[model samples]
Target: MLLNLLLLQCRAGFESECAAEFMQHCVDVGQSGFPRFDAQSGFVLFELYGDALAVIQAVSFRSLIFTRQWCACLPPFEQLPADDRLSVLLPAMTELPVCAELLAEVPDTTAGRELLPFAGKLASAMAQRLRQQGVMLPRKARADWRMHLFVLSGRHLLLGVSPRRNGSTLEMGIRRLKFPGAAPSRSTLKLEEAWHWFVPRAEWDARLGGGKTAVDLGAAPGGWTWQLVRQGMFVSAVDNGPMAESLMETGQVTHHREDAFGFAPGKPVDWMVCDVADKPARVAELMLQWALQGWCQEMIFNLKLPMKKRYQAVQQCLEEIAEGLEAAGIRFQLSARHLYHDREEITCHLDLRVS
Candidate 1:
């Protein structure tokens, strides 16, 4: 069969949560599986007792919070002779569905980082072989499945398949970004990445235009505020601490020395961004209040998770926000992610679809 197992990738040390999510997905799809994973391994293998096409078709990648990337896989090709790795891998892929692209991926771990160079070489060689063998087709339409090779070592690897649009676009489900020197803090990257994931790139110019207004709660030394300034939007930076003078000098920011929970924008703003270090529920509640009261059109914020039941925490917070918004007759779009830049917290983006 083409697929009997699944390979899932996530941040290192988040394997248990990822596994729990995958297990629940299988149940949701009416399939059964026993998850195999080691905590902090950065990957999981859900060994389905039968085929996996049902779960693959039923679950959407964006709906999963902990899993970064996933593929329906056949059993691995282990213990291949070191010298001729491609010889074994090529024949295995021959019987699978049509594939136009091959992604060479590794776990997000110390050892996996070291194998990157080797994975690249193997992918290059395999791509040529696949083309020559007529297994790889020209992707005229964007509908083809992308083959994934989860390389654990030069000799041991698991092969899998994922639909192009249904899975993450980045290789191994990780986005690598260089921090800007002028940004006030590394936290700036969190909001920036959330923008890329939530706001479509083409719509950025329209939605994030200059002259638009924004509010940054808990803004201090202004990390999130810096991004708004760069967008050419005026910012009401709410916090008691001092802000970066360089940002203040730009005339784009008005620093408000006050508590975020107690602070209210004098008028509705274009965007609301928060990174307050509080309970996940509280942060989520603050966002709900802003949306319900018609204070901001869009928002991006973080939820600091607890030591245990992290998945449950994220779900409860998001659900509460959705319930509050819907009950109050507000229509909106909401999404969250355990972004590449986030640590012990998940980032969320909410847009009140008010004209």
Candidate 2:
């Protein structure tokens, strides 16, 4: 029996966690698969014995916390001649069905970085050749599939495909979000990336723009608060530490010298964002409280995980939140991911919507 493959990209040091999560997901869906990974390699491969595409379809990308991006795999080509790597790759590209776009990527490691320029150049050449061969669809056509070329080195490559509906929106599974210099803290990138992942750019105005009131817990130096202010929303920055004076002067922000866990607003706000340093369970409970109490319609927070059994910790916290929300008769959508900018923690987004 032939097996199919799923390729996943994750943080370099957390390949084991990513592999463990992938295996658990496969088991949860009643699929049989085994994971292949190396610590600090920044990738995982799950080979499924049954209908691999069906298994991939059943798994939601948002639920896989340790994974940054993923794609379905085709047979890999090993040790091509240095002089004509494209010639070796072309046959494989032609064998596949139509693809909307081609993403040329390397592993997220020093070795991978060294091959980036080569991958970029190869991707460009492949796109042109695929178009000429009528193997690539036009931009305006419905994108059924995305081709992924993972360059192991100048001489070796792994080919994969992801259905448009289930794959990363970006070519390489990396969202290249720019960091604004004006933001008071680098941590601001976390919220910015979360919004990009959870909310569509077109819906930003209706869902998170002007007239929306937000509370930023642990808002000292105003990293998260700065994002809110930029959206033209009024923010109550809560913390014992001083916020960025520039952010405070914007007059769009009001600083509250108080504890985040104990603070509550005079009235319910549109959004609540937290980045406080606390135990993962404690942070999860805080998030559940705000949602259950109807303090905010939406929330985005971080959970700092323990050194051991990190995946189990996140799962337990999420289960607890679900039970609390269900008991409170609240309708909500919760999703979490270990963002590229994150270290030793994961970011979660919850939407407390009226049923």
Candidate 3:
């Protein structure tokens, strides 16, 4: 029997975890699929017997912890002439529905790094040719489809389409949020990526703008706290370690030398961010407590996973959090992802829905 395919990109070494999560999601939605993945390949393919669109619709990308980006798959082109690849690719382009943009990507692996320049050049050339041929829609056009070319090598690729409403907003599932040179640690990218993945940019002003207050648990060196302050939020930075002097100089942060778990805000704050190196369960409990007790209206935290049973561990932690929140009668929106910037950990965002 014929089966539809879905392509998912993820961090290398976690392909099994990603496949496990995808398979579980399919089972949860009553879709039957088997995932094909190899260790450290940085991508997974799911062959589904059911309607692919139905499965994609049932699973929101934001709720997926292991997947970085995904798309409905097309037949792989195994042989294209190196000198004139576009000639072969153009026919396929003509057959596809009009796409708003064309994105060329390579796997996130050592060997893939060598093809980055070629992939970018190819994408540029393809965009020009496809536009000239009217195969690609205009930039301002109201097109829903995005064309993606996953570069396997200079002469081969896996082509796919991702619908804008359900797929990643950025091309190739990569979030290119620039690193702030001023931020204290590289960990800043973790929170930045979480915001872009979980929160809509149009709603940033309303949800994370200035004059709001936040608490940064384990805020030493202030990576997460830097993000809060950058949003113009007054931050209570909780940690015993020294923070970045530049951040402290901003006068927007108040340091609390106390354990993040034991500390309580004088009143509810707009946001709470944590990057404490701790067990996933402990972090989940802290998140549930803050949300249930109304200590913070929103939170972004990290859950460091174990080397073995990573998927199971993540589910157990999330289930615990859900049960606690549900039992407390707290209305909340929770989303989790194993971000591109995260290693052995997943970022989670929780918003306490106000009645």
Candidate 4:
């Protein structure tokens, strides 16, 4: 049986855009299914057919899960028809029992930090419920479920609702989580929310082929470098400043002690990660060089943004990068977005085909 699919992002202030792009991607990726934008109902719905659940599960395992959220929408939630059908689809509610009851009990009322906890509660409850239902969800289902949290209150509060079958009864619940009160005041080089980075790092580690050479630009405090080292990649950390004491001791991480712009590996690397907090255009240029010059086969990086015209700036950056790659006759696939953990910035994933 096919089910409707929906995707949600945790970052407050980014639902409509996230929903639009995510649904479009789902339409393309979902061969057994297609999206139905139910703006009237304020959610995107998909008509999924054979193996629809499997495809969603697959995408969610890959790049579909961002930050603390899962972008793939869980159906029946968006355009649900009745409560009885809901009962048949939900899980046991063991992992987060509070979620199963509380989510359904509370209306969207709170904001900010309180809301995210609500999301966590819901995820826990949903996992419990799914287990009871015998749905046999993938391991990632718990972590990525938050992406379905919708932004209804000026994008400040997030809400997520899902149902999993629990034998003859459907256990359903709703979850809400709040975003941070303010953006970072300084570039401390230490992540306030390391979990956000960790999840994506795990995803990257899984996708990376069994190669080990990596370069981490702007490697101070070593947050990004730490992940690379832990993945068993030999990392040349390039930064004029010192790395974190812990990461420096890892031994797998090499301190290049230089500027990222000027430093280059002796030979091509399997991966390059840049979180330099530089202008988007400059970052895009750097990525172009790395791709065109055969410096790296894959890259995961971030581009800081100007507050005004965020979309315009990002759009232009993508366009220019596309032109650059085209002019150089390089074959690549690139994706950029405002990550759930990001504030005034977006992460970019670029892969270049190498023979």
Top TM-score hit = 1
All candidates' TM-scores? 0.96, 0.95, 0.93, 0.55
Task: Point out where model 4 deviates above 4 Å.
Answer: 1-10, 15-211
lDDT of 2 by residue, 1-355 (tens): 1328888898788888898888888889888878888878989888888765577678877678887778777766778898887777777776655787888888888988788899999888888887887888865678777788888977778887777787687755677778899999999999998998888899999999867999999898998999999999999999999999899899999999999999999999999999999999999999998987889999999998899998889899999999998887878898898887788989999998654
Cα lDDT, model 1, residue 324: 95
lDDT of 4 by residue, 9-98 (tens): 234443344454554455566545545543223233444554434545544323432222332333333332233322433432222222
Cα TM-score of candidate 1: 0.96
Ranking by TM-score: 1, 2, 3, 4
* Per-residue lDDT value at 316 in model 1: 94
- Counted clashes in each candidate structure: 0, 0, 1, 33
Highest lDDT model number: 1
Question: How high is the lDDT of residue 203 in model 2?
Answer: 95
- Candidate 3 C-alpha error for residue 277, in Å: 0.5
lDDT of 2: 0.85
Cα RMSD of all models vs. native, in order, equals 1.6, 1.7, 2.1, 9.3
lDDT of 1 by residue, 1-355 (tens): 6477888899998888888877887788788888899878899898886676557767878878788888988688789899998888898887667888888899889999899888878987888888887787754535457888888997788888887778887888887888989988999888888888889999998889858999998889898999999988999999999999999999999999999999999899999999888999998999999998999889999999899999888889999999998898889888888898998999998989653
Q: Alpha-carbon error at 238 in model 2, in Å?
A: 1.2
